[model samples]
Every structure is written in structure tokens, then in C-alpha cells.
Target: MAEHAEAEHEEEAEPRPKRAPIDWRRGREQAFSILASIVRWVGLIFAALLVLHVIFVIGSANSANGIVSFVRGWADGLSLGFKDLFTPSDAKLRVLVNYGIAAIFWLIVSGILARIIRRIGGVVSS
Candidate 1:
């Protein structure tokens, strides 16, 4: 029928939609989201950090405060004491510890968001 031909013509004539320009702000937003993801990933769900803190405290009981305490000393001694210049010990232990703490912290944080959403949902539903 003529209607069928007309419909086909209309469909073919319609131009394809153009994609919108990415808001550069979106890239910044993604960066922030990534940071937030890292934090949440470590803080809420890993839940093992509390245990690590406790263990670190107990295990290091003698040297207990040594690591944390030495943080200040490390700052003062940095230039004199290898300056964290990619020394095997610094690269492996310190970097690994920093990354581990960050990851666990973010993982545990995700639970906080869940709790918040649940509370809000309960309020909204009620």
C-alpha cells in the first residue's frame, strides 16, 4: 500500500541522532567517583581492618608503637635514611601496607552507604 511506502520513506529520511559532547566535568566526576569507590571499597566491607589494628597493636606490643611512632622519626630521618628512595624494604613493606590499608578501608565503607540507604528507604516507605 502507499502508506507502507510512506512509512518506509519517513524512516529512511529521519537522520540519526548525534551523540552529545561529553561534559569535561564528567571526566572530573569520574575521577572523584573513582576516589570515592576506592574509599568505600576499603572502609565498609573489608571489616578486617579492626582486626588488623588490634593485631598490629598486640603483635607489635613491644615494638607496639614502634611503627606509628617511627612515622614521625621517619619524616625527620627521610633524607638521611635512604629517603624512601625505592629501597626494597620501603617499596615492599611501606607501599604494601599503605595500599592494603586503603583497600580495606574502602571495602568496609561500602556498608555505611548501604546502612544509610536502608535507613532512608525505611523513612520514605513509612
Candidate 2:
């Protein structure tokens, strides 16, 4: 019985798990490509929009008012939880508050998108 116990122990010790070697080069390449594509597309779209905005602004002074109206609606959502940025009130505070809220929201969105892209990169690499 003692010999049988020793044999079992020896067999268990001898059958170690064999791990496959990791290929770092291929993993790195996949990660790099995923991030590069995301950055390229995002930058191209942002640049195109900015250029169009600049052209519109230069074409006519009246277009400036349109830009202001656009911000007051879409960009104003961030301030819903906060106090009136503009009362008959402080015009400067209102502008600052609006911009501050927009900036915070933009940062949060950008961070989440970046993390998602990075995770996708890891998945593709694997």
C-alpha cells in the first residue's frame, strides 16, 4: 500500500502542464494596428469638420450666429444639473460655465472611447 501511494504521488508530480510559448511580436503588431486605425479615422473626421467650420465662418458673418445657436442647444445639456450660468445675470459666468461643462463631458466621453479601443486591440491581438 505504501508503494502504491508513492507511485501515485510520483505520477502526479511527473505530469506537469506544458504551456505554449507566447509570441510577443504578433501580439504587439495587432495592438499597434488597432490603435493606429482608430486614431487615423478620428483625427481625419475631426479635422474635416474643423476645416468646414472655418470655411463657413469665413464665408459670411451671419454664419457666426448659427454657430452660437448650435452651442446654446446641444452644448447646453451639460449645465442642466447646475445653476443658471446666465441670469439677467452674469454673462461671463454663463459663458464660462457652459464651456466648463462641455469640456468635462467631452473628456469623459473621450476616455471611455479610448479604453474601449484599447480593449479591442487586446482582443484582436490574442
Clashes (N, CA, C under 3 Å) per candidate: 20, 0
> Each prediction's Cα lDDT score?
0.50, 0.54
- Output the lDDT of residue 5, model 1: 100
Q: For model 1, how does the per-residue alpha-carbon lDDT over 1-52 read when each residue is reduced to its tens digit?
A: 9999999999999999999998665565555556555656555434344334
Candidate 2 per-residue lDDT, tens place, 55-83, comes to 44344435358774454444445334432
lDDT of candidate 2 at residue 50, scale 0 to 100: 35
**TM-scores, each model vs. reference:** 0.31, 0.37
For model 1, the stretches where C-alpha displacement exceeds 4 angstroms are 1-89
Worst 10 residues of 1 by lDDT: 74-83
Candidate 2 colliding pairs, count: 0
* Model 2 lDDT, full chain set: 0.54
State which candidate has the highest lDDT. Answer: 2
